[model samples]
Target: MTTTVINHIHETTTATTTTSQTQSPPSPTTTPPHHHKQPPPRDHHCNHHH
Candidate 1:
């Protein structure tokens, strides 16, 4: 009986974790580059001459 209860608890916890992972929104760092602008390239010529 104790083992059965433990198994049920383990199953519930696993289901909760899986649900949370799927329901949570993606983080900004994981977002695609197309959603954001690229920074302009630095002027390498000025740096080299200086």
Candidate 2:
């Protein structure tokens, strides 16, 4: 019974992992090139003013 339960859980975990990998490509949507570059420019301007 214990082994069966473990196997079932493992199978479920593997399925979920595969689903997660498939969904991973959209993660780059959160990272915009302009958004990343904006912060460094702000920091440089702040230091120049100081």
Candidate 3:
């Protein structure tokens, strides 16, 4: 009777804790930084006069 109730409580607490831990968001340090897209290369034209 009492033992069964206590066991049920313990199981519920354990399950709640495990769920909360798993659902928690990851830390910032674990995520990668966002980078901007690179610009296209430019063309250069040179004229020589002698």
Give TM per candidate. 0.43, 0.44, 0.44
lDDT tens digits, residues 1-50, model 3?
Answer: 99999999999999977775665334322332211222221112222221
Sort every candidate by lDDT, greatest first.
2, 1, 3
Candidate 2, residues 8-35: lDDT per residue as tens digits? 9999999878876766445544556655
Task: Give the worst 10-residue stretch by lDDT in candidate 1.
Answer: 34-43
Best by lDDT: 2
User: What are the lDDT figures for the candidates, one per model?
Assistant: 0.64, 0.77, 0.54
Task: List the candidate 2 regions with Cα displacement exceeding 4 Å.
Answer: 24-50
Q: Model 1 over residues 1-50: C-alpha lDDT tens digits?
A: 99999999999999977775765445444444524544322345467677
After superposition, which runs of candidate 1 have C-alpha atoms over 4 Å from their true positions? Answer: 25-50
RMSD of each: 7.7, 5.2, 14.3
Instruction: Please give the TM-score that candidate 3 achieves against the real structure.
Output: 0.44
Total residue pair clashes for candidate 3: 0
